[model samples]
Structures are given as C-alpha cells and as structure tokens.
Target chain A: MEIIISILLLSGSFFIFLSALGIIRFKDLYSRMHSTTKASSFGLLLLLVGVSLFFNELNVYVKTILVVVFIYLTAPLAAHAIAKSYREKDKE
Target chain B: MAINNIVLLLSFSFLIVAFILAFVRLLLGQGIYNRIAAMDLIASIVIGFVLVYAVFIQMGLYIDVAVIISLVAFLGTVAVSIYLKNNTNKNDGDNH
Candidate 1:
C-alpha cells in the first residue's frame, strides 16, 4: 500500500516537473499552454488518486474524485479559451 | 516507513523545482498569455503539493483544503479566460 502511494506521488511530481520544464523550454504560447494544461492535469490526477488511496474513507474518496473530475472538465476549456484569445489577438 | 519518507522527500524536491521553473516563465514570458499559462501551471503544481502534504501527515482535512484550492483556481482560470476573450475582441477593431 505504501509502495503504491509512494509510486504515485513520485510519478505525479515527475509529471509536474516535466510540465514546468516544458513551459520554460517551449518557445510559443500554444506550445507552453499545451505542456502546462495537459501535463499538470495528469499530474493532479495522479496526486489525487494517491491521496484518496491513503484516506480511503467514503467522504474523502468522493471529494477526491470530484476534484479530479472538475479539473479534467475545466482544464481543457481554460486552455482552449487562452488559445482562442491568443489567436484572436495575434492574428490581427 | 522509511520508504514513504524518502518518497515524500523526492516529491517535495521535484515540486520545488517545478515551482521555480514555472516562476521563471511567469517572470520572463514575452507575452501575457505565457504568464497566464505559468500562473495556471503554478496553481496545479501547488495542488500537487497540497496532496503530498495531506498524505505525509495522514490528515483528511488537508484534502478538503486541496479540493477548495482546485475549485478556486478553476474559477480564476475561467474568469481570466473570459476577460481575455473580451479584451481581445475589444482590441481587434483597432489592431488591424
């Protein structure tokens, strides 16, 4: 159990680390947005899963799942909004 | 137990590095969009930090805080995104 949680935490942080690195390394707005939006979402997902595993109570499990789902539903929309605005502003 | 401590330590270090990188982008980004993205990234990484802290201390209340942070961050993203769209549209008339 501990091993599984540890693995999740390590891997999630790694994902976030890579995501941040990409944000710095990428040269464009779209590329930076891509890296931050996708990688961080996944990183959050893994972290939530690991956390819920440790807690494992009904309420905590539900709350964790809710947060993960909310992030998934909103993150892409936020990225899309930014990208669309970028296009709108830059094209003119 | 020792393994858990090691894992948590590794996670904290990684998250700190992530924060630093994102902060660099936030500071040096050429465009406002890049800065916005960096801010968003920081929020997500902080959420990761909250999660790790929760597990490290074996506390359930901390998870609730994590949930609230995520919710607030999402709202912020939406608000900023809407503002960006409106601002862009307003500027489009004069841009070209």
Candidate 2:
C-alpha cells in the first residue's frame, strides 16, 4: 500500500512538472494551452487518486471523486474560452 | 516508513519546482493569452499541492479546500475570457 501510494504521488507530481515545462517551452499560445489543460488535468487526477487511496475512507473517497470530476469538467471549458477569445483577438 | 517519507518529500519538491516554472511563465510570457494559460496551469499545480499536503498530514479537510480552489480558478478563467472578448469587440467597434 505504501509503495503504491508513493508511486502514484510521485508520478502525478512528475506529470505536473511536465505541464509546467510545456507552458514555459511551448512556442505557440494554442499549443501551450493544449499542454496546460490536458497534462495538468491528468496530473491532478493521479494526485487525487493517491489521496483517496491513502485515506481509505468513505468521505475521503467522495470528496476526492468530487474534486476529480469538477476539475475534469471545468479545465477544458476554461481552456476553450481562453482559446476562443485568443483567436478572436488575434483575428482583429 | 522511511521510503514513504522520502517519496513524499520528493513529490513535494517536484510540485514546488513546477510552481516556480509556472510562475516564471506567468511573469515573462509574451501575450495576455500566454499569461492566462500559465495562470490556469498554476491553479492546477496548487490543487496538486493541496492534495499532497492532505496526504502528508492525514487530514481530509483540505480536499474541500481543493474543490473550492478549483471552482474559483475555473470561474476566474471564464470571466477573464469573457471580458477579453467584450473588450476586443468594443475596441474594434470604436475603431470602425
């Protein structure tokens, strides 16, 4: 159990690190948005999973799942809004 | 026990580094869009931080904080985007 939790947390953090790197290194605005939205969402998923496993309680499971669902739902919407506005501004 | 502690430490360090990188992008990014995207990324990183801290201390309360932060971040992003769109339209209208 300990090993599993540790692995999940470490990998999640690594993915987040990757997301940040992409934000800094990606050349184009759209590409940077792409990197930030997808990678970070996955990273958060992993982190929440690890937390759920570590706690192993009903309430923890529920809250973690709620957080995961909320994040997955909103991250893309936020990205889309930003991208749409960006393109519109660029057009003008 | 020792390995778990080390793993937690390492993951926390990773998150810290990620936060710094995102902050740099937010500060130095070229355009408004770049900064907005970086800000979103930073919010996600902060969520990660909250989760890890919760695990580290074995408390469940912080997960609620995570949810709230995510909510705020989403709303802020959408609001900024809407404002940007409206502001651009106003500018174009004035010019034309």
Candidate 3:
C-alpha cells in the first residue's frame, strides 16, 4: 500500500512538472492554458487520490475528495475566464 | 518507510525545480497575459508543494490549508482576468 501510494504521488508530481514545463515552453496564451489546465488538474487528481487512499480516517478521505472535486470544477472555468480575457484583450 | 522518505524527497525536488522554471517564465513573459498564465501555474505548483509536504508530515491542518489556498488562487485569477478585460476595453474606448 505504501509503495502504491508513493508511486501515485510521484507520477502526479511528474505530471505537474510537465505542466510547469508547458508553461515555459509554449509561446502563446492559448497553448499555455491548454497545457496548464489539463496537466495540473490530472496531476492534482492523482495526488489527491493517493493521499486520500493512504489515510484510513473517513473524514480525511472525504475532505480530500471534496478538494479534488473543487479543483475539477474550478480549473476549466478559470482557464476559460482567463482565455476569454486574453481574446478580448487581443481584439483591442 | 525509508524508501517512502526518499520518494517524497525526489517529488519535492521535482516540484521545486518546476516552480523555479515557472518563475523564470513569469519574469520573461512578453505580455501581461503570459505573465498571468505563468502566475497561475506558479500558484498551482505551490499548492502541489504544500500538499506533498502535508502528506509527508502527516498533518491534517495542511490539507485544509491547501484547500483554502486553491480556492483563493482561483479567486485571484478571476479577479485578474476581470481587471485585464476592463483595462483593455477602457484603453480601446480611449483610443476611439
């Protein structure tokens, strides 16, 4: 179980590391947003699942799950909002 | 347990490296939008760091704090977006 948890966490960290890479490598706003949103959300999902699974207590698991859900809901919306602003700014 | 510690250390190192890269990108961004995107990435990476630290230390408080940080970070991004929108529109109107 510990091994499984560690692997999950490490893989998640790798995804986030890639997300950071994307932020640096991508030239424009849209591509950067695409990389940041997808990679980070997936990374966060994995990390939350790994941590929650390791904890036996019910509430901790529940809280982590809620946090995951929160990230899922907010990430895309925030991305959209920022992208829209970028577009609007561009039109000017 | 020792292996787990080593794994955690490696993960932390990766995150720190990523964070530093993102910070450099933020500094070098050509425009305000790029800067904002880099800033957003920075916040997410920091949240990732906090979370791994929390789990490494087995602290419940850090979990809650992570949640709060995520929410606040989201709010900040939205606020910046709105500010950018208004700023652009105002500039356009002034030019016209």
Candidate 4:
C-alpha cells in the first residue's frame, strides 16, 4: 500500500514539474495558466493523500482532505480569473 | 499499514525536480508578470513540499504554514496584477 501511495504521489509530482516547465517554456499567458492549474491541482492533491497515509491521525487527515477539496474548488476559479484578465488586457 | 521507505525517496526526488523547474522559470522569465507567475508556481510547489515534510518529520505546524502561504500567494498575485495594470495605464497616458 505504501508503494502504491508513493507511486501515485510521485507520478502526480512529476506531472506538476512538467507543467511548471511548460509554464516557463510556453510563451503565451493562457498556455501557462493551463499548465499551472492542471498540474498543481493534481500534484497537491496527491501530496495531501500521501501525508494522510503517512500520519494516521483523524484530525490531520480530515484537514488535509478539506484542504484538497478547497484547492480543487478554488484553483480553477483563480486560474480562470487570471486568464480572463490577461486576455482582456491583450485585447486592449 | 506501514509506508515503505521507497515512497519517501520517490516523493523527495519528484519535489526536487519540481523545485528546479520552478526555479528556472523564476530566473529566466522575461518580464515582471512572467516572474510573478513563476513565483506563484514556486509557492504552490512549496506547499506540496511542506506537506510532505510534515509527514516525514511528524510536524503539524507545517500544514498551518502551507495554509498561510496559500492565502498570501493569492493576495500577492492579485496585488501584483493590479499594480502592473495601473503602471501600464500610467505609461499609456503619459504617451498620449
């Protein structure tokens, strides 16, 4: 189970790293936002799950889960807002 | 119910890779906005690293720090965006 958890976590983080690299390599603001949003969201979610497994406390697990949920809900909205502003600015 | 040491090793390597990519962005970005965006990525990656560290070290406070970092990153991005827009507008007005 631990190996399973680690595989999940590492895979997600690898994607996160790739995404951040894409952010640097991509020239457009929209493209960067896409990479950041998808990669970090999954990466952080895996991290939270890995921590929860490593520590068997109920409170911390719940809190970690909540944080993951909140991030999922908020990250896309934040990215959208940023992208919208960037596009609007480009238009002007 | 026990975690393998290999898991820890893999997680650490992944984090280091992410950190390096984010660092490259921070160093090589062409302008203020790009740099700011890279900083945002750094903060996000740092939060992941912090959570993993908390697990390895059995520290609860690290999650609290991650929470605070998230809040601050959001605000900082907004503040920088406003500043950039305002500065650009001022430059545009000056040109006219």
What lDDT score belongs to each candidate, Candidate 1 first?
0.87, 0.90, 0.85, 0.75
User: What DockQ values do the models have?
Assistant: 0.74, 0.78, 0.69, 0.53
**Fraction of native contacts in model 1?**
0.81
Interface RMSD values, listed in order for every candidate: 1.6, 1.6, 1.5, 2.1
lDDT (0-100) at residue A72 of candidate 4?
83
Chain A TM-score per model, please list them: 0.96, 0.97, 0.95, 0.87
Better-scoring candidate (DockQ), 2 or 4: 2
Off by over 4 Å in 2: B1-3
Q: Who wins the DockQ comparison?
A: 2
lDDT of 3 by residue, B62-91 (tens): 778778889999999999999989988898
Instruction: Arrange candidates, best TM-score first.
Output: 2, 3, 1, 4
Residue-wise C-alpha lDDT for candidate 4, range A1-92, written one tens digit per residue: 67766776677677677777788678877788888888888888877777777676787777887788777877776676566556546766
Question: Can you rank all candidates by lDDT, best first?
Answer: 2, 1, 3, 4
- After superposition, the stretches of candidate 1 with alpha carbons farther than 4 Å from their true spots are B1-3, B91-96
Residues B24-90, candidate 1, lDDT per residue (tens digit)?
Answer: 9989989888888888899898889988888888888898788888888878877887798787787
Task: Report, to 2 decimal places, the DockQ of model 2.
Answer: 0.78
Error in Å for residue A22 of model 4: 2.0
Task: Score candidate 2 by TM-score against the native.
Answer: 0.96
lDDT of 3 at B60: 60
